[model samples]
Target: MEQGSHLLFWKAVNTVILIAILYYLLKKPISRFISDGINSVVSRFEKIKQEKEEALNLLKEAERKSQEAKEEAEKIIKYSQELAEKEKQQIIAEAKIAAERVIKMADEEIEKEIYKAKEELKKFAAKKAVELAEEKLKVAIDVESNKKLIESSLQKL
Candidate 1:
């Protein structure tokens, strides 16, 4: 029993010495590895945070640009409508002017045609009167008197 107890005591002392030696030898490397792992994790978290910020900024910019585009589209539509209205008015005005000019020309043409008709009627009436006078004169004049008048006019010539 004394020999077994002595042997156990020696074994316990050896185990303690071995543990101490190993701890002293490996402590710095283990600590450095743990700290490096923690730093790497922290760096990854920071990178994620920065990416989130950049994404938010990009989203805001996109929203702003979308609003600007909407406003510009409205402006363009309004300008186009205004231009169309102006053109429509101008076309209508031009049509009215053309219609008035055509009416005026038609009136002038009608007056000219009326004047021509009146002149033709007057000429016809004068011709008819002259024919009637000739008929009357032929009936009134005697054949012997007409012969004497013609003979006298020839002597004067």
Candidate 2:
């Protein structure tokens, strides 16, 4: 029993001395390795953060461009609608003018036809009056009487 206790005490002292020696020998290299690992991890985290920011900027730019395109499309649609309305008004005006011109031409033609008919009626009346006067004269006077009347009218002239 005495020998076992002495042996146990010596083993405990040996284990403590061995731990102290290994710690002293490996401390600087272990600290350096741990610090390098921490620096690498920190740099990786910064790179990921920068890449996330860039992706967010790209997304914002895309959204802005999309908004601009939508605005431009709306403007184009409005312009087209206005242009079509203008063309429709112009066509209607032209049609009205053409209809007015046709009406004026028809009125003029009717006036001309009415004037020709009036002239023809006047000529017919004049011819009919002359024929009636000749018939009355023939019934009222003989050939001899017509010669005497002609000589009398000539003397008066």
Candidate 3:
């Protein structure tokens, strides 16, 4: 029993010494490997964060451009509408002037026709009166009356 106890004590001391030697030899390499891995992860995280920020900036720029384009389009539409309205007013004014000119021409033509008709009627009435007076003289007077009328006109002169 005494020999077994002595042997166990030596074995325990040997195991402890072996463990300490292994620890001393491996500690630096393990720490270096862990730090390198952490550095790699941190660098990758920074790169991702920078990319996200760039993408957000690009989105904001695109939104600004879109808003500008919309405003420009509205301006163009407004200008086109104003131009159309102006053209419409000009066309309407031109049409009114043309209509008035046509109406004036028609009225002038009507007045000319009425004057011509009145002149023709006056000529016709004068010719008809001359014919009626000649016929009445032939029916009512004889040769004796004509001789008397001539002698009286001569005596009076």
Candidate 4:
């Protein structure tokens, strides 16, 4: 009975040592590998998140640029329209001024021509009156009646 008890005690001691060795060699190494893998996966996820954020910021910038371009185009169009309207008004004003100047010049020329014609008519009428008075004097005077011409011309004319 004493011999059997010693053998049983030795066996129990050996079983405890095997369990300690397995825990140190296999269980601890497996736990370390699983922890490293989990950390690697978390780091990859963080990298993807940063990339997504960068892409979103780029998209927002593009949209802002598009809106600015549209505003610039609108401003250019408005400026062109304003310039065209101003040109049209200026052209109309110039044409009206030119027409008025032409009409005024024509009226002045007509007045000058009329005044010149009146002066010529007056001179012609005075010359014709003198010629007609001489013709009437010759007809009233006779060749042998010089002494009595004044009394005869006064009665005949």
Candidate 5:
């Protein structure tokens, strides 16, 4: 077997040229494209992370405001309860006063009715007694001697 130095040298030169051409024409563009795509992905991930952090902050603020509103509502309910209690007490006081007035009025009316009934009974009794006395005198006297009895009684007095 006879080896040719000429073929070996040509192969070495050809491999070197091919490596240079590939590096210049394909390796740089492919590497640059891959690097740009990785950068874009990393930037998009950062943007999403920032947006998530902002959303969490907003949620926290909303929770705080909701708690404040609940506290305010409880205070208002307490105030209204107090007002209702005061109104109930006032109503009870007014009712008591009204009942006292009504009792006093009823007592006065009863006293007036008793006094009027006594007066009416006395007047009726006096009228009946006067009629009975006139009837007894007429029974004891004679009709023919009525004028002579009257004149003799008048002269004796």
Candidate 6:
């Protein structure tokens, strides 16, 4: 072989030895770093999944509580309506009774007034009759007739 070719061959051998030594030195560290990164990524993914499940459970619980609240509100509204209706009925009944009582009282008062008016009319008629009778006697009985009546009454007595 020539000298130049022999030197190039030695340089190629030296380059191969250096590359192999570097690969051997870096292999374990690089592999360990890649494995640790993969484990971290898997752990993070699992944690996220667990968090999502917890969020879904919380949402379901909130929905259930909301439904219960709605049911309770309906019941309360129904009860209030029933109570209001009962109160309205009671008030109407009480008003009717009060009206009846007022009407009865008015009737009794009217009757009393009518009776009083009749009594006054009877008294007025009796007074007028007495005055008329007195006037009639005064006109019919002259002085001479009165003297004769007195003499007859004395004789009878």
The candidate that achieves the highest lDDT relative to the unseen native structure: 1
Candidate 2 lDDT, 1-157, residue by residue in tens: 9999999999999998999998998888999999999999999999999999999999999999999999999999999999999999999999999999999999999999999999998998898899999898889899999899999999999
Which candidate has the highest TM-score of all?
6
- Superposed on all Cα atoms, model 1 deviates from the true structure by an RMSD in Å of 5.5
Candidate 5's displacement at residue 63, Å, is 1.1
Instruction: Report the C-alpha lDDT of model 1 over 16-111, residue by residue, as the tens digit.
Output: 999999899988998999999999999999999999999999999999999999999999999999999999999999999999999999999999
Output the lDDT of residue 34, model 1. 96
TM-score for each candidate, following the candidate numbering: 0.69, 0.58, 0.65, 0.50, 0.71, 0.73
Superposed model 6: Cα runs more than 4 Å off: 1-19, 132-157
Looking at model 5, report the run of 10 residues with the lowest lDDT sum: 1-10
By lDDT, highest first, what's the ranking? 1, 6, 3, 2, 5, 4
Q: What is candidate 5's lDDT per residue for 1-157, written digit by digit as tens?
A: 1357778888899999998999899997999999999999999999999999999999999999999999999999999999999999999999999999999999999999999999999998998999998898888777857988899999999
Give the Cα-based TM-score of candidate 1 against the true structure: 0.69
Q: Supply candidate 4's per-residue lDDT for 148.
A: 85
In model 5, the runs with Cα more than 4 Å from the true position are 1-20, 136-157
User: 89 in model 1: Cα distance from truth in Å?
Assistant: 1.0
| Superposition error at 10 for model 1 (Å) | 7.5
After superposition, candidate 3 runs with Cα above 4 Å error: 1-29, 124-157
Candidate 1 residue runs with Cα over 4 Å from true position: 1-19, 128-157
Kindly indicate the candidate among 3 and 4 with the higher TM-score. Answer: 3
Q: What are the runs in model 4 whose C-alpha is more than 4 Å off? A: 1-45, 121-151, 154-157
Candidate 6 lDDT score relative to the true structure: 0.96
